[model samples]
Target: MNKYVLSLLCVSSMSFAATPFIYHDFDEAMQIRNYPKAFALTNRILNYDGKQFFELGRSLYNQYNPSVLPSRSEPIIPKHIHQIWIGGPLPEVFKKYIDTWKQMHPDWGYTLWTDENVRELFPLHNQSYYDESEGMGVKSDLLKWEIIYRFGGVYVDVDYECLQPLDELHHLYDFYTAYQPLDAFFVQLGAALYAAHPEHLILKHCIETIQDDWHHKGAPKKSGPCHFSKSFMAVAGENGSRDIAFPSFYFYPLGSKERVLRRSQWVREGAYAIHHWAMSWMPINTRRQEFRTFENERSSKVWND
Candidate 1:
């Protein structure tokens, strides 16, 4: 046997004899997105192979166990709307808006979605199959789904500040999303969608099926992943509904639709809430800026993920 192989065998033998202990250096690990380290720590605790290991880790990390975790139909009927103001690194402006929104909707749930934390929980390499164009690619979508599954509510980009109460749209939608036609003709601005319906299994199945198709495409027949709108349509079909009810403009402003803002004058007419969308913060040119001044403002509060 080779000398290196003999050394490896000895190490393996010793490792087998001694038990593996799982230790998580969460504080240090969070400094940089230490997915590999987190994965290794998880592996030490569970004897599952690489396949089962990842699923187990994700389940634990997201606090998603079908048996233990509360179901959507359980005691929590959600007295107030659960919302998230997600973006890259949170800005000071966000804190101000969160405070104001909380005051307006006292029972609302608020969460911050940061890029660093997402990467740690769901790495791109781990997704079944990924494509770049589907909002954030398949990997990102799966992570988003995980969030919805765990939290059970609506998600809005931080760029979209609240202007009115969201209580009006308590149970109008089955699966909620920021909808826009590929042509940008009929766009639903702002990220307000309902997901508390019992029939959401239809939407869930559609998402899983598309993910399967992407996974099985194989290297020989590479293709762009399915668009999110297409998947949403699939959900609508499964739920036996012609159209998913999107919250009316009262929840969002006309400027929220990125395309409509360029060609139309809805923004000038005084819309309720503006949706910055993808380019929410970045100014296109001096003439076209994404930020809007708010009349009311307040302080901030901290919450753990």
Candidate 2:
């Protein structure tokens, strides 16, 4: 398997009070600008395979059983937001996008995980993957799990713009995630933006899903949103859900009809955040140009099939 290409299995580890850490005035020089160069033809082929969602879902379901997690709900989740960057210095626009996050939620704590200190999050066994893994998308997917399981807060991509304080949404669920599009329903979950309380079973299962498949699969695909949906749906079935899945309007305005950011600065009422669809994980060449079209193909497979 080409370590440079981001595989679909999103995996992670939990060792101690020493899993990865984040927050506080992070580095100004963040590699958060554009994605890197072209991927090998072989790697590209592997990534495209995950478009088969039903097969992936069934495979994941067979591997994992639902967890009867504790009856924990919102407000229990920490008022923290975790974002990660693992490449060259970030673009100036990103700084502004993140700063808006701070301005909107003065009460919430913010953490920016970056390469300068990424090793601080993973364990010894996974360190080799970290060193060898080439795609920032893969690394970011791994980092989000650690942060969610350890810190218990909201996680967003650098491109997400905060419209209002997240207090209303964060204080409602123990392991809540945003859907991709209301029209498609449970077709896909936005892996990049989700919330969880520390130690939630769904998050652990997410970690396990990635770890179990990491050897054969690349992450940010196999281990990302699709993996998360399996864990979430399984757990929701085992234990009645509690404000667990939210509509796209909550955190995914860009993917929905009310693309407020594109038409006008004002979003429809009740929207809290907007993902600008800044696909930093995409290969910087022709593959990136096909980013939206590729993602659209995901709709062909839904949660049921």
Candidate 3:
């Protein structure tokens, strides 16, 4: 009994003759544009008996998407930004990007979680996992979900440069994701920048699965994009319906060769952020040619002090 599939109108009045009367009432409600009543009638299909949603539904992994229902009334994700710096000092270029986020949204709350603070802020078990993770990327990925889930705000990678203020997005969605430029089967969600309300099911599934399903050797496959992408779509409806996503073209203009071999003029114009592709975790042999360290002069865009 997939309650979500129940027709838009199926409320019962306990009589065969009640069908026509119900339709008449429904028509009147629609004519009056009473969306609240229409929604209530639809929710009746679930016959909710006050059981916790976790116990009632088989899995929220298939709930309204991009990953969760849009926040049309009041935003669920707070107007805060969370970033991680679990290692040493940030590079000058990275710091510049962080400042841009503040310049763009000075009133929004900002949190920079460092190694010392994360241990105090996060649970002991999480500290163990963070301590054991191989690289900065892995450690950051682990905290990205937990911190955002615990605090309900936008978690952004320190390397991501903000081109625009993210305040407007808060008005429309409880969960939002950034996508890679391309995918073989489904939308490839980038972990670099995303917003969510605390205890969001998608984030919950990610946190729970990372511990059990973590067999991969790399961060992307372990807890980064590859892992998060599968969890994201599995919990979302087909093709990420009802969910909000900013495509790669709008986030990572110079995507890796695998995706947007090169960015088009239009793509650059539309981009709201830039991921400077600082692949510090890659081995010397594995690192891509273009991921220069911040020392080499940057080909800057939308950069602010």
**Could you tell me every candidate's TM-score relative to the true structure?**
0.45, 0.64, 0.64
Per TM-score, the best of the predicted structures is 3
Error of 1 at 160 (Å): 1.6
Pitting candidate 1 against candidate 2, the one with the higher lDDT is: 2
| Residue-level lDDT tens digits of model 2 in 233-262 | 545424532434544545665653333444
Error of 3 at 149 (Å): 0.3
Find the number of clashing residue pairs for candidate 3: 6
Residues 1-305 of candidate 3: C-alpha lDDT, one tens digit per residue: 43411211121111112111011121221122322242233235322221222111213322432234344666567999998875565555467667767766778899898867777665733667766655777777888888888888998887776655565567656677755543222234678888887877788778888875466666766778767765665574333333444544556555543433332232224445667666655543343544444322221210111
lDDT of 2: 0.53
TM-score for predicted model 3 compared with the true structure: 0.64
Q: List the residue pairs that clash in candidate 3.
A: 61-235, 65-241, 65-242, 65-243, 66-242, 66-243
Q: Residue 291, candidate 1: how far off, in angstroms?
A: 5.6
Strongest candidate by lDDT: 3
Which ranges of candidate 3 are over 4 A from the true structure? 1-73, 124-127, 183-187, 237-242, 258-269, 284-305
TM-score sort, best first: 3, 2, 1
- Model 1, 129-181: lDDT tens per residue? 43232222223344444455545555444445444444433332334333221
